[model samples]
Target: MSFSSIAAAARPRYGLSCALAALCLSYSLHANANTPPKIGGAPVTSVTAAHYYSFQPWASDTDGDKLTFSVSNKPLWASFDSSTGRLSGTPIPPANVGTFTNIVISVSDGTYRASLSAFSVTVRSLVNSPPLISGTPATTAAVSQPYSFQPAATDPNGLRIVFGISNKPAWLSFDSTTGRLYGTPGATNAGAYPNILISAYDGYFKATLPSFAISVTVTQASNGT
Candidate 1:
């Protein structure tokens, strides 16, 4: 055979081998790529002394790889679970009353790691108290008449209080900051609105007024028959 013919025969085999090598290299690189684990949670920033506090960060790994948990600047009064990333404990008054700062929780999937943003927990010396809500809501409302009721609340710790209502009537509007429930009922809205609950939250604790109801009745004619 001529030298040129020998070289041409070998060319096809060399090209085939190179293509197979490239395919194997691509697969190897993808199979070995690592995915990092993710961790996140919103822990309460303020806790009262002698009160129980707890938080657990959620984590996940798409590769189903086993994950390990870790923490930095954990509070001395709290206990941690390495496998689950839970931080919880009670702060003893006078001893643990202070602020713990720059606490970070992290997770690792052996090859890669992820972490939550640094956060802080403040332990207050005063005991926590639930906000107070006191008032009687009128049970009966007349259609086409303006109706209104405002609940009063006080928080001993003077924390900003926010109001909330559940099972509210469709005809009424509520003020979250003032705890005022007011609106006019229409003829179509005449019915018994039951199990209405008004609540106050003082940042940490909640106090709820006893459940009440309102019955809408037809408006009485102004001129007596």
Candidate 2:
């Protein structure tokens, strides 16, 4: 072959080799590209002092890589679980009862990382308050009739309230969580139940309502003249 012809042939071969090399390089880069780890969850913003609190974030890596968890500006009383991404502990009064701000939680998969939005936690001291019991119970019920009474109760401190009765009747049933007293009064259950005092209790205090009575009697129609 002539010199110019040989040169032109070599030029096409070189160009083809360069194109194949570039295609291989692009495929290698795309196959090895790393997708970042993803982390997210809603963290508790407010907690009562002397009460247990916990927050756990969900984390995952699309590339199926092992993840490592990290936290920044963590509270002194709280502890972190790097493997599970759990933040938990009890805050004490007078010391940890304040706002902890700009807390960051992140997860890394060696090549890339992701993080949840920065958050803050406010710890407030526990202030106890007595629960209030309201509503009236019926004083009389007829035989073979359904009788129901539920005392409305609430706590000022937003704590849970449990109910109790000092002199509950044998024919009635009481629910502690909702303060409901209910039952059907049969003919044999017709009688006078007295001195029934309903009480509400929070974790730190208790409140009681005035004592009441329930009287079950046979209907006048049943004892027709």
Which structure among the candidates has the greatest TM-score? 2
List where candidate 1 sits over 4 angstroms from the true fold.
128-225
Give lDDT tens digits, candidate 1, residues 1-225: 999999999999999999999999999999988888888888888898767889998999989999999899999999999999998998877889999999998999998989999999999996667888899989998887888999899988666799999999989999999999999888889889999999999767899999999999885642122
Q: lDDT tens string, model 2, 1-225?
A: 899999998998999999999999999999999999889899999999867889999998888999999999999999999998899998877788999999999999988879889999999988766888899889998877788989888887776788988889888899988889999887888889999988999766789889999988998754563
Backbone clash count, each prediction separately: 0, 0
Work out the TM-score per prediction: 0.55, 0.64
Task: Give the least accurate 10-residue stretch of model 1, judged by summed lDDT.
Answer: 216-225
Q: What is the alpha-carbon RMSD of candidate 1 to the true structure?
A: 11.0
Worst 10 residues of 2 by lDDT: 216-225
Per-residue error for 95 in candidate 2, Å, reads: 11
